[model samples]
Target: MTSSPLSPYLRDFERLADLETSVHSLLSSHGQEATFHHVKAVAQKAAELAERFSGNVEEVSAAAWLHDISAIIPNRERIAVAQGLRLEVLPEEADFPMIIHQKLSAALAEEAFGVTSQAVLSAISCHTTLKANASKSDHIVFVADKIAWDQAGTPPYLPDLLVALEASIEAASLVYLDYLWEMRARLKVLHPWAKAAREALRADVSKLQTDKSLRF
Candidate 1:
């Protein structure tokens, strides 16, 4: 299905309720209360950003709620499950399989949840480490997830991230990626998608700044 099957006129009054119900039930059944709460927070934040940015709110909300549905899978089996689903296994995913949950979650969103929108699936596929040329909905969900982080306290980067977000979604994404790049030494392996995304954002943001400088 297309990235957007539901009309913008319907807003959150339609599929969002059923999607939330299904996701909540699945997470509860798995005893993943923390994940359920985190997804809810992300969905809320995503919807808000979608409205602010004139993005596809329905697609963003659906992806946000389902983004972490695969977290219940044990990290050890993540690579296996991703392979079983016929998802590409990056070298980084092989070394640190936990990173594959994003892809697994997208697969499950389609297989189990019956989600067909390519936009929604794509957002779910890269919510953790956003890819290059991400759509507006992708940016919305990614930034929302960071804004509503699962940690006990506010994310250390939230203040800076929010400031960047006010400027543009790409800027906010770059802010988070910059943090990840700074902490790369501690990461098990840096996913190539994330690396490419950071470089793309750097170039995009620099060009935007340069264009603005020229205009003024």
Candidate 2:
């Protein structure tokens, strides 16, 4: 697949460098080196997958770099920032404030960085939990995010987690759903989006199980 025409605009090395510097500054302010490293890994993975998929390499790279821009702010501040930018978000989803970072990122891309393409914005927003009517770009970014290969030092099960994601979207979604359930149980905060994501994956799991039973 040929990359979108927007590729040139995104691949400007100077622009990407500025974005990286901005991200580092934001993370430094929050004293969150872990988050910075995670985003950097995600960006690297996004770039590799974008090249393979012949995606708009520049747009995908930019999206990956800025996907978590709003996460540096406090949870309460995130909501206000998102609202100020006219980003859409659900009230119940407010608990995991970082989730809104995706939307805020798109806004920043447009207002601050002169990015006006919907494809770029969609790719960034859908990197976490996907929304309905996702485009090919969205799917590419989503898969890249799930299969990021920088977890070598993580627990043994982490590799398996990536393997499961690569094997099937249903399997990956089920695993994510289970993980979310455990998080909610332990955190005592039932984020609305988290619940919704679990329910969606649960339905997928049910369908898969039913299909397997029929096959047997």
Candidate 3:
């Protein structure tokens, strides 16, 4: 028996799914199973969250799934690789190479899967660093990466994040940033991206408050 032709949406999803499968094959054996589960969770969360707002669901889904592709590289060497990629590495980023995975993942998404959408690439690239002026797609992936998956034990900020999700993507991101800040503060090791996210989200959210203040 022959299978029926896939609908456009199904075809698209399947094509991306095939790429995902290839990515899985390329993934190193270490922690592959757990990483696969984490990526799927992040993709689902990114898609759902993007749908709640006017984000690019496709971009969010793809980026979220592929955001950690470079994790195949050992975490310890991330800083060395990251430094080699850039001429001037920031002190904080040089100190914490794990953040380099975002850029490496974005590059891998492009080279491996031919991802061209800046929205998608930007989401992948800054998912960790969360550069200033992040688009909705970027913000959605960033928030989903945190709220959907956690390497640490049960995330203590889930309740706060859920509340923020009801409020807005900007709000959810702020909550996540706050969670990161608390974690880093306790560890006494702050990644540059965390600082960038905090400042960017604060600026983004403050605008709403400023507008409300003027209206009242």
Model 1 has an lDDT value of 0.85
For residues 1-216, write the lDDT of model 3, one tens digit per residue: 432211111123222347567556655343466777788889999999988897888889989888987776677766665555452456765666666678877766765577898889989988875767789998899888887675868778888888988888888888877877878757545766668878978886788889999999
CA lDDT, every model vs. true structure: 0.85, 0.63, 0.74
Best by TM-score: 1
lDDT tens digits, residue span 1-216, model 1: 433211121133222348888787777766788999999999999999999989998899999999998876778777766776577999998988888889988887876678899999999999999999999998899999999998898798899999998888888999999999998999888889999999999999789889999999
Steric clash count of candidate 2: 0
Question: Which sequence of candidate numbers ranks them by TM-score, best first?
Answer: 1, 3, 2
| TM-score of each predicted structure versus truth | 0.90, 0.64, 0.83
Candidate with the larger TM-score of 1 and 2: 1
What's the lDDT for residue 201 in model 1?
93
